[model samples]
Target: MSQTIAVLDFGSQYTQVIARRIRECNIYSRIFPYSVTAAELRKANVSGIILSGGPSSVLTKGSPRPDKKIFQLGVPVLGICYGLQLMGKLLGGDVAKSDRREYGRGRLTIKKKGRLLKGLPKSIKVWNSHGDKVTALPEGFEPIAGTENSDYAVIEDATRNFYGLQFHPEVVHSERGDDIIKNFLVGVCKCKQDWKMSNYVDQAIQDIRDQVGDSRVILGLSGGVDSSVAAALIHRAIGDQLTCVFVDNGLLRLRERDRVEQVFRDHFHVDLRVAKSGKRFLKALKGVTDPERKRKIIGKIFVDVFEDTVKKIGDVDFLAQGTLYPDVIESVAIDGNPAALIKSHHNVGGLPKRMKLKLLEPFRELFKDEVRALGKELGLPDEMIWRHPFPGPGLGVRVMGEIKKSYLDTLREADAILLEEMKRTGYYSKVWQAFCVFLPVQTVGVMGDERTYDYVIALRVVESVDAMTADWAHIPHDILQIISNRIINEVKGVNRVVLDISSKPPSTIEWE
Candidate 1:
């Protein structure tokens, strides 16, 4: 069925931000490629269309463009930044490179009011990241708003229900962004608030069945929300054909082993294999301290372990992954924009050339929150579904220096205590990520009137919507005191405890 709003992505970093803002207005929104047709959007029952901004210029050779048929669908269409330029250029308007590009917050003044901009501030801050601007308005379109840098900042044609903006209102930094989106969703398009997470389950199951008909599949069960939910959906589709391999890299949290076996092996009853390769992984990572090298080593080991397991189960046709949109954006190029590579997430799987298993990742189009909602629809336990984000490298990347069994043990216990205290003080769910980092440096401390030196453990916690940006979470003093005291007294080979007050810009959550 059609949605209340359909956003066609042209590889913008803020594409997800647009979908999120619409949801904040209590309306349903889904994203599709710029190649999506008006027929597809109509089949989805879309009431409105949004063109997301991208890094590419409309004048660039072979840049992405929306389907020509979308414009003729006669729905209320809103365009942003590059989106605005694309619409105007395609519909008999002139577009060119601006001599002075607007790249940050600027003032937007209303030249005329429309239903979309109604009840909005006459002047408000808006974010801009575009080098190209519409030089001439499209036929039948008139200017509705403008900034100092661009004359036709916002244009609209009420007769055709077309609107365009030179700035992004989806960004949180944009003033009155929420109200602007509300006016578009509720006042302009009149979308009904009728999307439920649970409504997606049955459709997903049917799609899975159609894709994996009688074919054997191997799933990499990471115990994270994405993989677990993907496994559940595939299990429902192919039944006994799915085999999940769980490798214990010795970098996992306290009792992580028990939890994996209990949940997947015992409860879900999917074919689960637990490869106890902790000793081998530790030995391989003994002298590696560079963060990039550590991630590469772990990723290689994971593939090797998984490849070996797949050989044991002969003739698997597909390798199922839980790849998300964030993962893809960081790892690979899309829409001709070669993104800088981020961490080598172990979940990003490419089997050896010798192993010929096709990739099957159903969650590739979704973000983390959408995956969590799917987890809920699959009837996953709250604790398993809502667990704080864990890195694929486990504690291997958490430790500051070279990996060691001793360091792994100490870090695990300290992190467990941190988790416990967080839950006790009701901070576990409040913070995005809270964990212990084993600093390589040691400080002198007095114990029982004797001076001693041992490794220091730092507690780092932060809150963020997406892990891209974050701020230091201000933990309560009492809870901090209790956590610090317990770690020092209980965890051995540790003398002092410290708190990390640095945010993401200055410091990442991990020590390594």
Candidate 2:
């Protein structure tokens, strides 16, 4: 078994990404809050501890602080960003408000050679996002690295197995960041990288068996990869004790409903209950024009429909969902209150409160790509494993204005053609997410000297590590032209096509 590391989150937006990096090193990891007790940490048998950066400044009154007993655990501890400042303040150091706040990329120079900086270059570019800087070093800790603005950049307390870095190494902009984390896990903590997808599958099977025993579990399959993999894992664990309930909200793509039922029933040999609630969902979303309201309505209806299905299928003790790490991080509020909901994350926020079933989220710590890797490890089909992420509300939110079957069908056909052409050109695997959004506006266009007015379709493709920030994928002009021509000629009701060039901060992935 691989050694387990516990990452204590301070409500940072990048907490999940930090855990993902550790898993990428082939090591098992879990995330907890700063308020987690030392006894709880001991129960996990954590070989090492990591403190995640938070959005709050350490000098503030209401800022989160870790359990002081964590340092007494006598295990290796690494802190990043705000975590570094917290360690400094708790251990006889000074952290003052910075006159110059660093929000993006910067260079750091390593002054001393230590185990953490062993394989890294002398000067490395790193991602920094912090308002305060460590002005003084804690006692028994030496500064290993520093930037021109901050002298106490990287501090290490070898005696206590404590390390802290001012820069965020979990992000990709910090190129050698993974190596730095590996040096701490392997060299400093001496942990073996034995964790893999197969190990996760075996452990998850056992975990499910132990938790459920003979109890029944009802999982909601969304036809997306996450829920599909979750259902398969649960079925493998307890066999007939698992029953899958799939709800068709009428917002899915063309033939998605049939494909979902066929894949689960025929290929996986799992018990599936298909509920067609298209009319109910469309009825609830009749005249709702607000984007957030549309999402909430769809989410509420999904829960109600799911609960009704569960009642019909005997008694179920658990509800299994495919809630990934990004979902959690994005939904987490910066205020450090677990009860405080951010956006209505249909899986994490909406269902748990309304339904009485116990939650079972196996992929809570895994990122989107990591979940796909686990899906492949379990022998899932390529189409299911590599499918682009569709939101819980589906294209209902993407339509922008009203709910209509005709418009949705047209959008789905255009999207299918776009994906097919991208796959043929070998660009499907390269982009993070690519899809078609049906615009509420229409324009006049000529198809052989005949003027016609039809709906305009917008294409969006973005590349991002986490959904927090993204850049528009630079698709080839030839490919874009082909996609545009095909949508205009093949898919009816769409006269003009346009590509979205906006990034994430200024624009969301979906038009809504």
The clash count of every prediction, one per candidate, is: 3, 0
Q: Which residue window of length 10 is worst by lDDT in model 2?
A: 332-341
In terms of lDDT, the best-performing candidate is 2
Tens-digit lDDT track for model 1 on 1-512? 45568989888867777987886665677778888878888788889999999888889898888888898997889998988999999999999999999999999999787987888878989998889989888889999899988988889988988889899999877888787777778777888767666555665677677887888999888797778888998898789999998888898899888888888977799999888899878888989889888988988888788788888888788889888776666554554443345555666646667777877888766677777888888888888778777777889888998988898899999999999999988899998889998988889998788888988998989898766567889998989999988998899988889988888656665665
TM-score of 1: 0.89
Could you tell me how far off, in angstroms, the CA of residue 323 lies in candidate 1 after the best superposition?
A: 3.1
Segments in model 1 whose C-alpha atoms lie over 4 Å from true places: 23-28, 35-47, 67-69, 96-100, 185-190, 334-342, 349-353, 505-512
| CA shift of 441, model 2, Å | 1.0
Cα lDDT of model 2 by residue, 16-90, tens digit: 778888888989888887898888898788899999887789999978888888888878999999889999998
Q: After superposition, how far is residue 110 of candidate 2 from its true place, in Å?
A: 1.6
Which residue window of length 10 is worst by lDDT in model 1? 332-341
TM-score of each: 0.89, 0.94
